[model samples]
Target: MKPGADRIELRGLKVRGYHGVFDFERRTGQDFVIDAVLELDLRPAAASDDVNDTVHYGELAERLAAVVSGEPVNLIETLAARLAEVCLADARVAAATVTVHKPQAPIPLEFADVAVVVRRTREESA
Candidate 1:
């Protein structure tokens, strides 16, 4: 299997975090929704039917949640970048795309959500 030919996706990972440009946002905190797509070759796992041959998405989810809950950042862009880094931490993941959604952003008008998306590869991450 070639790299980037297969994908494992985790969507709608919601965690409360203190990340925003405003002081009140940081103090009060809000729900941050995360979505991640990890690109890699999954043939080995498919053939062997072993968890070790592929990324364990459940474990990855937990790790991502930890990141969202851990540090306080100023921008969803930074948060997205951090999540991409976490996704790429697994050597088997050739690339990762991370999206961070802020539903309660301090916008004056009505909006569904504000978000940032970032894509990173192992080489770029290095």
Candidate 2:
């Protein structure tokens, strides 16, 4: 971890998207729950008490939602990766972990949910 490294988390951000192998899934979009954890230095924000010193989570949420609602993908893994990219777009974010939940997955049996989690560093995203 870098100096003053702390975590900023956004959890349970739900958006409707068309991301799945099945044609029906794409035709009728489903909800995807997203969780993102960002690792970065928070001391600047703490000291200055300025929003500019830290990551603006509300804007981040909007960006992530746009990704989820925009293009269609065949896998949640791709979606998670895309979300990681969005999180790492900020230079302040050293690393990020993104999880995408597919609650209405096509399964033969009953299950709680299906999700994919991806972790990436700023370098990797770049």
Model 2 lDDT at residue 4: 27
Q: Which ten residues in a row have the lowest lDDT in candidate 2?
A: 1-10
Q: What is the lDDT of residue 45 in candidate 1?
A: 96
Clashing pairs in 2: none
- For 1-126, candidate 1 gives per-residue lDDT tens digits of 566689999999999999999999899999999999999989999999999999999999999999999899998999999999999999989999999999989999999888899999998988
- Separately for all candidates shown, the number of backbone clashes (residues 3 or more apart, or on different chains) is 0, 0
N/CA/C clash count, model 1: 0
